[model samples]
Target: MKQSPAPSLPSAEAALPRLPDRRQSVQSAQTGMVVLKGLANIGGNAGLTALAAHVGESPAKVHRYLVSLMQEGLVDQDPATQRYFLGPELIRIGLAAMRQAEPIRHAEPALIRLRESLEVTCFVAVMGNRGPTIMRIEEPGLPVTVNVRAGSVMSMLWSATGRVFLGLLDEASVRQMAESELAAATDDMRALLPSPDPIGTLQREVRAACCASVRDTYLRGISAVAAPVFDFTGRVCAVITALGASGGFDPSVDGRIAIAVCREAHATSLKLGCVGPPPAAG
Candidate 1:
């Protein structure tokens, strides 16, 4: 008798299913995140077709993910427009994250990097009641002699740091303070200001440059560059400044030092939730 035909082995396709792999689980999580981020990048709301195109996924796959996100309150769709938008939970999470982000804390690393790489004194200055006040400072091994300290208040018309605030902040308080300072400026300080229309000219220049640099204007032999660090609302929350002896520092708007400062400020602003291109260096 033909013995029973030799036992046949199961083909791979006929084998029983194995448990889901860990990597697949991780990938699923990552894909979910991609969907969420894609929704945010496209003005925070979009039709399923648009969102699928933006995320480079099929509409069916995106819809499945969107359903899961909705279950978790991370996304929601409007019945009338049939468009998906970020949900309340996601907004709450973002707001909570923003509340935890401290401008000084976010800027400290940039300040350290600027100080070490550029061999200059770098600081974070905030608009305080007195004016722009230094909140944090980093100095190189051989620091320059700039009398200012952590709490030192800078002059709106005299300091590179203050000028960034003066140019970016549109509040009447800032303008009033600048005017008061200009009115009380000594003959030497007045002479140092631009002729004809110092305030108007300074604001226009700083806004145009997206940064401010001064040479031998704030203090004798001292040069500095300052760039604004904006918050999520595109408001100037602080200024990052790097200063050194005029002989060693290049304060030109397009110079290496200024570009570095602007880049660093832009990075710190990103950490603080600001969205946009980096501040213009030149």
Candidate 2:
């Protein structure tokens, strides 16, 4: 026994797997990121105490970091309200990002395909500051007569694209927009605005269907069918419209081009992450 003492076994701690050293991790970056994310979520102006609570940091600590953020132009404090807001840098970045977005960039090929297959004039319209404006256009080789260009603004009540946006906009907003149009209405447009009821009726119908149609509303003998395209935020990012002679294309909910346009719009919407019917058109 004295000559054969039992050999000692390795300890349990030595039997465990090794974890890589994390000494290179930057704690300051972690704090800065946390603070920035918190500020973004808070949105608008926030005071020191309010922001501190929102970010789960002490007021003094948050203030110190905010000062650093201000130096980088990532934050701005109001001299009057003593509230902090996201700075001009974020605005500049956001505007730049939006300029590059071109929501209908990938949708052009689909528009071309639809036009070629349907033999109808097709276009994408997005809500603009003035109203629903055509962003892109695709036409069949044949002589079509609707007279709309890429910059053309459509009637919020008369055109299919316009109706879709009207359906998506709130009542007050629609009323205000309608009033503005009415103030500048020509004799022809005055005829269109006999009363808001007609436009209201169209808005209700479009909202119910998430689609709309126009026959001789914008142009006599011209008919159009439009379907709403939704984006990730559930807003109607764009409207796809198919147009041709009144007799050539059907504008009903179950019409030929209506079905096709809706299908194309649905496919486009899916690409942009829409899961349900469009919620907004802006």
Candidate 3:
């Protein structure tokens, strides 16, 4: 009898066991996670019946998972209400995840994607000692002509990137920087700002839009859209910006470029362990 043909490379690889496959998952552990997620989804404090309904499991089975999770310290129950809540161990794990989050590192890949997909210049800016400063820049094949580069300090009152930091952060120092910029600006430059309460207006508009867009404000002939990248603490740690020549760029807050920028910023914020809604382009 002819021997069976040797296994192909793909077949050989497939024969090896891989982790994270459903077949490799411990059933008990998967059930426990489902129960935990159900608890979290029901506002993190729910009765057995609600959790059971949420997970589409019998109360008895979900209870068994809950008991295992309790032993693992992943869940807890209130003595008075007999309701399940996310346990101290979950908080500890969350804190650990937050501690490892780095804003710039998480945002760099997003910038590159935005540059490639949208064909616009993109950058990540962090609030530096001087002001909002560019940390990384990603330019398209034909780069837009702008004065800013990596490490360049943006004008807190002028640039879309700087305005995003100013709008989200409630820091006295940041406000002071904006004030100083406003105070030192010439009549021509000051005219570019919103009338009758520029800072207040800027903050309101940015907060409402969940991002900032500028047309010929910071750099003449250059338009930009910027969105905030938040940390787990909900603080705006950095801003992601995309800019292009005004002739070709749409600077509307609700335009495609703004939406893409906000989506990337929201994704970066998620990688930084931030728990919040996506930036809505208003």
Best by TM-score: 1
In terms of TM-score, which candidate is stronger, 1 or 2?
Answer: 1
Local accuracy of candidate 2 as per-residue lDDT tens digits, 1-282? 369878899899988887655553466667866787688777657888988999899999898888988898888999999999988987787567555545588578778988989998999998877888899999899948767989999888678888887776564665677567656768785675435566667767887777888888888889888888877567777889898898777788777778788888877877775565433221
Give every collision pair in model 2: 236-280
| lDDT winner, 1 or 3 | 1
**Whole-model lDDT values for every prediction:** 0.94, 0.78, 0.90
Candidate 3, residue 208: the lDDT equals 91
Q: After superposition, how far is residue 95 of candidate 3 from its true place, in Å?
A: 2.2
After superposition, candidate 3 runs with Cα above 4 Å error: 1-27, 41-43, 53-56
The residue-by-residue lDDT of candidate 1 on 1-282, one tens digit each, is: 567788999999779788789999999999999999999988999999999999999999999999999999999999999999999999999999999878999999999999889999999999999899999999999999879999999999989998999999988889988999999989998898898999998999999999999999989999999999999989999999999999989999999999999999999999989888886789
Better of 2 and 3 by lDDT: 3
On TM-score, the stronger of 1 and 3 is 1
